[model samples]
Target chain A: MVWKIQGVEGENYLESIKNFLNQLLKSKNVDAVLVPKRFPDGNNTAQVLITDPGKLDDIDPLAPVQMVNSAQIVKELTKDPVKEKIASVLRPCEVRATIELIKLKQILDARLYIIGYDCPGVYNVKDYIEKLEKSNGIGKEGFTLSYVNSFLSGKQDTIRESCQLCTHFTGNSADINIAWVGSNSSDVFIEVNSEKGQSLIEGLAGEKIGDLIERNQKINKILDERKKRQENEIDDFLGFMQRCIRCYNCREVCPLCYCKECLLKPEKMGYSSDRYLRRATKKGQIKMPVDTVLYHLTKINHMAFSCVSCGLCEQACPMDIPLGRIYNVFGRKAQALFDYEPGRSLDDELPVATFKEDELKEIEDVKE
Target chain B: MGKNSVDFEPKIIAFLCNWCAYAGADLAGTSRTQYPSNIRIIKLMCTGALDPTYVIKVLLEGADGVLIGGCHPGDCHYINGNYKARRRVAILKSSLETAGLESERVWLRWISASEGVYFAETVKEMVEHIKKLGPNPLKMEWAI
Candidate 1:
């Protein structure tokens, strides 16, 4: 229940991860190592993939921006039946989303070694790179640990809207919890939240440990403020989303989105000429790219029950739509109605997939 | 038969495939055989080319019932068009029924180039049934 830490610079975090994997590789303890890789385009961008331990040293884990949710990548990789055990380094969001994917049968495994990290915040890759490009102090000189620490101290707006409202900033269920925030120092807090996490902690023979109680409390406080900010941001975000051209980028990037055929495609479901004419007559102007509300509703009704709130959908939007908040709204409702949290645990049943006679009766009764 | 009992006459929309069923209908005409006048044939290339949505749309838009006629089993001019059509109807029927629509509103029948007698009888049987049952409730609702 207690979170723990060891002080190291952000630059050292990646190097330490490489070192940890290198040690595991030497021992031949795991089959593959999953890490973040830098994009070739000179942007402060990174993506997640399962790579061999030999490639661990080149991983850009400390890269200041996020483009895609690592959880989705992990879900794709883990979906196939595999015999080899792989160790995946996940941010808190990734771990949470991955849990939901596991429940949906989108990702399958007993062979995954999840190493969860405490996140300070991450910027949208494009926005972050643009800001970094304009700033004089930080350029291609490479972001050092001190620079990140300074940025954190100033409370600059580096985080995405999804990240600001992220309540689950600390991963609750991972084989190993690599803590960063909530403590007085920048040291990594390593605590085992589960039996496997404890085993991983015990496996680290020479690493120093520190108290994580104050750190967890600080994390909780930040989460509280972030939740309130998230609601306001969602209102502002939806105003921007009304401009969406109906591109499916948000759906494509979403990790927990496992539908084989999306209901939004015009072929499956689109406004007929009759519906179009009706809308035109009623509203005086026909909404182009029609059924926008229905598209979101159908998707939310179908999948919100298992939404992991990974926020990759927002990142993938070309329109810069705050799809994360829209998803979170429905997802929060589905979770509350069923008293089921997606990705919180592997054994939990997915709400949409599982049918119960008495479930959602209150809502059903209201309808009746 | 009881005095109050009306004989069941099935309402049928025979969608004749241009190659087979339509040819059969034409043959029925040329042969000078007396057949039911109730059938209204809509010519199509192959039974497999049917879209279930189109079928549902028409059914909901006032078609009392539908009868999709295709080439018998392996006799389809477009290889497996009939086979595929069969599968689509099977899925559509169950889905529509689940959505509270009557599955009987849609019907699939495979009649080859030689099944004129069968086609005529099928149409007669359908008209008699529909006349007794009245118009489809769904069609009435959509109209309103």
Candidate 2:
């Protein structure tokens, strides 16, 4: 069911979201709320856990910048059971990554309420800061609203590439989704996607709205453009990966890469001066930062089946490699072969972790 | 290292599951079912334990091809190990394609203990395929 949340006549749409979250806190619907808030310096936004209703003033869930996939934050918060209920407001990508982490046994989701929203893709941190600086007097909220408008109108192209190609922009997996795809500026649609969402908003009064035909249409249009873009970029992996310096920033930011001791680490890779010299001797010429290609290949082997394509890895790359696009291409193919969609639901088993007797029969059929 | 010359012999690294493929290879040796001398076999406890990194390491270390031999479906001594191995190999092959590597260089097949002749023929076919494919482009001269 869809319900409308009223906005102050001329106030920003983000204000309406803040009002809803503030209600959740003030009315004791939830003990606390986890959402992104702008720093006092007006240069950054990060997730903050707020218990006080008054602290909702600076909450900007729609800010067009994501420093990290908040799914990791959710994992940190719920790794152990908490006495008080926490409502985590996350972007769709983060929500999906959180679901994957839950399946990987990194999170205990017993008392957590996942709140997701329509993600209008975000810009890279450096690019976002530059845009913020250029919009001199406009506050972060104002600048973000205008940026989102331009993006929805197809005039903005500065979003990270993974987001550009993302077909799953809506938070269908969240319990409660703050839907704005087809809704007007004066009000936002609150969708109760699951039983938890239904129970959470039981007493809140709002106008009931039916199926959003316009939203579905808009989503299809975006998907077509993204599929075309993906086809154009898929084969350029070798060129993009050539400049990697083996920094492992991509691995560090990935929410699904939840290994306690990563295989890519120096100790795990068994790196030594003698090993490097020997590799150099054998190769005749070796790149200074060795195993750049191997590091990526190993990562794909490990987690491509679970990759949510949030693109945090792309944002974290120092070499500007499109690691997100590369992983997504491989992930899409691998997941398709097994007819699996990671993060679609908790019930779907990871492809690598399970198998069927009659499945993948072609692997045994040797064509002479 | 004139890899393109007719005298060049492709080096193939084969990881055989001990329960089925390794026994089959041994049977081939004892039965004198002659196969090419290009393959160097490593016996693994189970194909499910085969890490994609080993396949990658050998290729990067100058092996022209990788051959993974496991038990037939439902014939694995450890229940469904071969099934899991098949899935891993599939994912690894797709990843290799994405990395601009020749995925065809990696082959997966089932070789039962009783099928020693099939095992010899499979090796012969793999060696010929690798010879035609030439040396792995990522192969380096020094040991990895």
TM-score of each: 0.63, 0.94
**Reference-based lDDT, each prediction:** 0.62, 0.84
**In candidate 2, what are the lDDT values of residues A94-143, reduced to their tens digit?**
98898898888998887788899988889888988988999988777789
Error of 2 at A66 (Å): 0.5
Candidate 1 deviant stretches above 4 angstroms? A1-11, A39-42, A48-54, A135-158, A183-186, A198-203, A206-211, A232-242, A270-285, A355-361, A364-368, B1-144
- lDDT at B110, model 2: 92
- How well does candidate 2 score on lDDT at residue A81? 79
User: What is the RMSD, in Å, between candidate 1 and the native fold over all Cα?
Assistant: 12.4
* lDDT tens readout by residue for model 1, A198-238: 54444444544556567657666776677676542134322
| Candidate 2 whole-model C-alpha lDDT, 0 to 1 | 0.84
Q: Candidate 2 residues B37-108, lDDT tens each?
A: 999999998999999988987876778889999998889999989999999998998788777777888899
Per-residue CA lDDT of model 1 for B53-96, tens digit only, reads: 56665554456777778887668897777766665455455444
What CAPRI grade goes to candidate 1? incorrect
CA shift of A325, model 2, Å: 2.3
Model 2 regions more than 4 Å off = A5-10, A365-368, B1-6, B140-144
